[model samples]
Target: MSEFLNVNEIKEKVSLLNLLNKLGFAAQKVSGSEHFFLSMLREEYTASLCVNDKLGVWYDHGAAGVSGIKSGSIIDFGLAYWYPASFPEVLKKIVEYAGVPLEKSHDIPAVYAERKTALKSSTYQINSISETITNPAINAYLNMRGIGSVAAGHLYELHYSILDSKNKSRNYFASGWPNENGGWEVRNKYFKGCLGHKGMSFLQGAANRLAVFEGFYDFMSWKVENPKDPASTLILNSLSFLQSAKARAKQFASIEIYFDHDRAGMLGSEEFAADVAGSVDCAFKYEGFKDYNEKLTAGLSASKKSLDKPMIFSAENGFGR
Candidate 1:
């Protein structure tokens, strides 16, 4: 077997829920990291597949339990889902989707704790936030995304430096959006990450209805299109804040969600709608585009084409480690 098929390596790094999402399996419901999905291998009125995102494992109670195999790693789940596909083929496909196996570190929980610690001890610091769009790279980035200067003003220029896994310091200058926890979600042509606490950012307005977006760029795109729309805006910098958004929704009369059209996004929209009464999925406006930014950049002509492609990550080569 190839090194990519290393069972322990794949089990440690790849998120089963993310894998299922990338494979076009939308969860019927998500609670915390546990995603309940209708089994892809069999037809059923109810969901029997559950994936634990935190553990990178899954359980198909209906099928696996019949054989006294109650649970398994992502590899096992993939083998069952892909049916006649040989073990090698399924493993290869998983490796491609998940990127190279991550280097062995501490256990999942320990590593998670360390990541939180690293975030708290970040060497990066936000020097300032300017309304000006002076950086050519940032300005070009916005232009490429079809975000105008006026809309760009909503984002700030961030200055920070981070040490990579090798402990080498590197500086960065990117567009930043401030979240509620006073952290910055930094983005540029080459990088995407957060600098502080990860949470939602809201723009206070007089409207009783709130417009929820998956990212600040999407919110900016919506602003470019509906500058006068007075609906209060909420941008979940990440989907983990969806529950928090649901709780916040009680304060408003209704909410209009504009999430991406990907499997995760579509499934999250469903869960969000189920949690918040009078919530409307507004993603239909984008139609075939992946997200609002994509719709903006691709234009009407591109919308005619399909965006149903596998989820590709920057870490696909060797960055996953």
Candidate 2:
């Protein structure tokens, strides 16, 4: 007979923070008891997923589970993270990744309480925004994603500081771009977040046509490939802005979507197509890859490997000859 698993027991044993770290996600920002992270559940440029370590709960401001619940316990996170996996499987994976033995009693450490009290009041402040991208680290990050050349005009160098209640401050830098509301969608290799109000990034072009992408990097990748295509562009920044993008997309005669090939992206593309009359689902152009950036990087890698090799996107697939 198999050992029966108690959901409550598992929740108590696992550390959500540790589990997230193990899953390759670290808190990009923290305020009081809330820790913010780039939503692993979806492609988002901002940290919409906020986890309250003290309460041992998390919520994705960008999206909700199939049940429409946006916030829940670690068990809920496990269920959503390993969607379609059996309950037992999710529990097992959570335990394995969290590295918590079932038989042991896991207690919340004193450090958490101390840190919470120390950072009870904190604020993230934007120190400066540069019109040019000059940081070697940010440039390298952009280059690694195959967008260094094109990212210059589209992104900015942002210097920001996080100050806790104790008056201690830590300054950081990232490459960023602005959304419609003047908020900065910032990104470094290790972090993804927004500096102010969260919204979409739009670039004006021809009135009749528009191209939509899930994130800025995907838009940059598309720009790298089609430098002269004059379609007006919108980077949804986060799929949370899908409805808003759809509303704006209706103004154009044609719309092209370049969302990821994942489930959320597929559904979002379908939703956009159904809602907007002339929208085209261009994700098929990079079908086997996660997103346009990934496909672009793969092609870049392949080119470095063999110059004569054909690029990943060819004329027949609607990527333009």
What's the lDDT for all of these models? Answer: 0.70, 0.78
lDDT of 1 by residue, 82-199 (tens): 4334455666778777566554333233432343344333345566678776888998888878785454548888777766556577788998888775567788999776664345
Clashing pairs in 2: none
Regions of model 1 farther than 4 Å from truth? 1-122, 300-321
Which tens-of-lDDT digit does each residue in 1-321 have in candidate 2? 455456677777687988987765667689999998877555565678999988999999985532233567887787566643445666778988888878533343464334334322344678898988888999989998999989868999999986644668889999999987546788999988766445689999999999999999999999999999999999988776676688889999999999999877897899899989999999988889999999999988887768655557666785432
TM-score of 2: 0.60
TM-score of each: 0.58, 0.60
lDDT of 1 at 223: 86
